[model samples]
Target: MKRQIIASINHNLGRAIALLDVIDSKTYQDTSIGPYYSSIGSHIRHTLDFFDCIISGLDTNDIDLTARKRDEVISTDKDAAKDHIYKIQETLTSYTDVNTDYLIHVTDNMGQGKITVNYTLESILAHANSHAIHHYATIGYMLEQLGVSIKIPGFGYNPTTPVNKREGI
Candidate 1:
């Protein structure tokens, strides 16, 4: 299960890297798309920040989801965002012996107030994986709006989504 989880994350991160390779700096930082006016870089940074929180809090056993880097450079620079993604991939690679079932405290604000809840390391990783995909889908929309043709297969889709639906066939 741990191997599968890690592989899935690495694959998704690879897709992000591929995207960065193709898009220019302007497209990465473009915020002219929608009602919220969020850039692709912002979504990428936000997704990575979640993983950063997980990786940073692993040793202490207390993950704070609200503690995000929110780095402007990462949000405005394609190279910086790619570098950050590479760093995250390398860090995840180093955790070869993590126990998936280990319980840890996770702090996040779901609504009215901040709350800390117990979660298995596997569960949180799984949530983060899904979260990344969700952000990727948003990025896909932005890319389409910006007239960038992305060819990376399954780049912004959940594994369980039907192929026909993903391709609009």
Candidate 2:
């Protein structure tokens, strides 16, 4: 289970790196699209920020989502985002011996106000993986609008998606 979870995290992070590699800086930071109007860089930064929060808090056992670093350079610079992604990939790899059963507190805003809930490290990591995929899907839509075709497979697919339904399956 630990190996599977780590693999999923690395897989999504790899897609983020691939996205940076394929898209130019202008396309990455563009916000000309209608509706939500979020850029691919924004989605990538947001996804990485969540993972950063979890990893940074692991030793302290106080995973505070509300206190995200929210690095602006990552949102506007493809190189910086890729650098951060690589750092996260390295961090995830180092956690192979983590005690997933250990309970930790995750603090986040929930409409009413801030709330801290007890969660296992395993559960929080799983949520982070799913969140990355969700943001990747939005990035995929943005890429479509920009007419940039990325060749990386499974960039935006949920793990639960049937194997036959995924691209290049």
Candidate 3:
């Protein structure tokens, strides 16, 4: 189960790299570097931030972390983004794939008097997958605003799309 789930996480990370490759490098660099939710690049950085945290948090429950910090943009340079993607992929593949019965500790940010839950590491992996989708949509919107379009692979071949649909009639 852990191996299968970890593979899915890495695959999503690969898709992000492929889709972003379709976007212009200059635009990727010139886009705003921000901590605000209004910025697209910030969202992408935010996704990577959690990727790092989850990778780390899988082992230690004591990392000083905040969700907002993950949302802040680290860099606008496409190379930086690519570097992050590669590093995070390395971490995910190196760690998650090997741990089968490892436990993950989950809690609300900032110790807000909420009960913490113990989950298998794969649940956190799924959270990152969901976040990647949201940020990918954000990037897709930002590209549209810049009059740039990415020929992303999964956007049209979804389960309901014609490319994925089969003839039954």
Cα-based RMSD of the predictions, in order?
1.7, 1.7, 5.3
Candidate 2 residue spans exceeding 4 A from truth: none
Question: What is the clash count of model 1?
Answer: 0
TM-score per model over all chains: 0.94, 0.93, 0.73
Error of 1 at 161 (Å): 0.2
Ranking under TM-score, best-scoring first? Answer: 1, 2, 3
Per-residue error at 146 for model 1, in Å?
A: 1.5
lDDT over C-alpha atoms for residue 155 of model 1: 80
CA lDDT, every prediction? 0.87, 0.85, 0.62
Which ten residues in a row are the worst by lDDT in model 2?
Answer: 160-169
lDDT tens per residue, model 1, 57-115: 98899899999989999999888888999899888877657555678999999987889
Instruction: Give candidate 1 regions above 4 Å deviation.
Output: none
Show how many residue pairs clash in every candidate, following the order shown: 0, 0, 0
Most lDDT-accurate candidate:
1
> In model 3, where do residues sit more than 4 Å from their true spots?
29-37, 62-73, 100-102, 110-115, 155-169
How does residue 148 of candidate 2 score in lDDT?
Answer: 81
- How far in Å is the alpha carbon of 64 misplaced in model 2? 0.7
Give Cα distance to truth, residue 85, candidate 2, Å: 0.8
